[model samples]
Target: MSEPPASDLTARARLRMAALRLFAERGFEATSTRAIAAEADVSHALLRHHFGSKDGLRRAVDDDALSAFDRILAEFDAPATRQGLLATFGTVTARLFGADELRRNYLRRSLLEGGAASGELFTRLLNGTRARLAMLSEGGDVETGAIPDSEAESDRLWEPYQVLFLMLGPMLLEPVMRHTLADPVFAPEALHDRSAANQRLLTRGLRAAPGDTREP
Candidate 1:
């Protein structure tokens, strides 16, 4: 098959962006292809021509949003020091979520609305978390001397979920959190502080190097 014309690709991208915005604002069931087409300044027939249906368009949007995290996840495929890993998390979180309101809102809706797509997204996140933890554990990137073996079984089993909750809590709650605290949680400075605090907490609470005295 021949490659699509450049104009066709541009129209497709516009439709996807429009769909993302509408879905974030009004949700999937409420938003229509016509509205998306109007938002993109394209015809409804063009939307159908590119993505077939609203659901197909949504899948395209989901795939595009998830691709960013896939790149972030790929960074963990190789071994790194515990701090290096944590630094990556901090940097990426600040960079990714802090800058992209549309993507963040889209994800918040997708995750909280509860659907097959949401479940799939959560599963992808869980798998990524597990892979990162495995790297930390198997590569001896972090020491778990702070945790006792007597309780290690359950901790090992549930750590990924726990970590994800910690990571996602602020993200999902960012709007409410910002309202309640009167703080911009995703601001660069705030994100940097949060990341630094996370690094400190993980370092002292879980991955302290030998004889390193750090107060939690």
Candidate 2:
């Protein structure tokens, strides 16, 4: 297909940004193409012509977000030691969770209302991140390793999921944790500190596990 004009591309980008913000604020089921179009100040026909449908637009947003995350994560070279792994993970977690308020809001909305799409995106992100972690953990034991490549493929596959869940738990549970906990400590800044602490604990535990000979 011939390349769309630059103006069209710009419009598509605007629509995607507008849709993402609106969806994050109002949710997927509640947000409409017309509303997104209006927010972007573009014609409804332009949105349809560019994205084909709301689902298409959502997928595009998901893809772009993930791609951007990947790009940011590419900066850190994988680490071999458990401490290094934790530090690496912490760095990445900080970047992902430290996104601007708007993006974080949108991501929260996606997690809440995007259903299968969100799950798929989460799976993809986890798997990709796990692979990187595994690569980083080369030469380390399954128990002590950051990613445990020696484990069964099924177990190995879950590493990224575990890491992601751990990283995302604070963001996902902040509301409930804040409500139920007497002294709430789930704020983003606090989560970052806790994540670092958890990583240190994980590294120590891993190093202490039976059959693990890795030195501190």
Q: Please give, for residues 79-162, the per-residue lDDT of candidate 2 as tens digits.
A: 655455655665576556655456656666788765688888777778778766776666443245344455656655566766
Q: Which 10 residues in a row give candidate 1 its minimum summed lDDT?
A: 76-85
Q: What TM-score, to 2 decimals, does candidate 1 have? A: 0.77
lDDT of 1 by residue, 1-216 (tens): 123443666988889888988999999889999999999899999999999999899989988777766565555533244444554565565567777778878989989999887898889878877787786667655544465776777777777776676567678988778877645988878887777767666656766776665644
Clash pairs (backbone) in predicted model 1: none
Compute the lDDT of residue 45 as modeled in candidate 1. Answer: 95
Error (Å) of candidate 1 at residue 206 is 11
Say which candidate scores most in TM-score: 1
Q: Which segments of candidate 2 are over 4 A away from where they belong?
A: 1-9, 135-155, 179-192, 206-216
* Cand. 2 Cα-lDDT: 0.69
The models' CA-based lDDT, in order, is: 0.75, 0.69
